[model samples]
Target: MNYSIKVTGLKYTMTIISATELQKNRIKKLVDLLKQCENINQQIENLME
Candidate 1:
């Protein structure tokens, strides 16, 4: 299972939220917000084998 991760920083709000369980009727708005994150967002910069 992938854990839900959310990161926020200065000049940015509710960004980089990689979620596992997206509740009903919230996908659109939530996804829009997620896109706000830039390089300051969470998650690995690159994935390797």
Candidate 2:
């Protein structure tokens, strides 16, 4: 099936597709990793100043 999430303060639509338990967990982990990576990148840029 598919899932949709409405983020706060955003008008865009997010779509996610999954078939089983493993798929859902994997997708969640990927999203978490992406957000962490962004934060770390920002920190690195700030430290270079």
lDDT score of model 1? 0.43
lDDT of candidates 1 onward, in order? 0.43, 0.57
lDDT of 2 by residue, 2-44 (tens): 3333233233333565357887788767666656666677778
Tens digits of per-residue lDDT, candidate 1, 1-49, equal: 2223344643323333564455422654554565546333544443321
TM-scores of all models? 0.25, 0.58
Task: Judging by TM-score against the true structure, name the best candidate.
Answer: 2
Q: Which residue ranges in model 2 land beyond 4 Å of their true spot?
A: 1-14
CA RMSD (A), model 1:
9.8
Candidate 1 has which clashing residue pairs, if any?
A: none
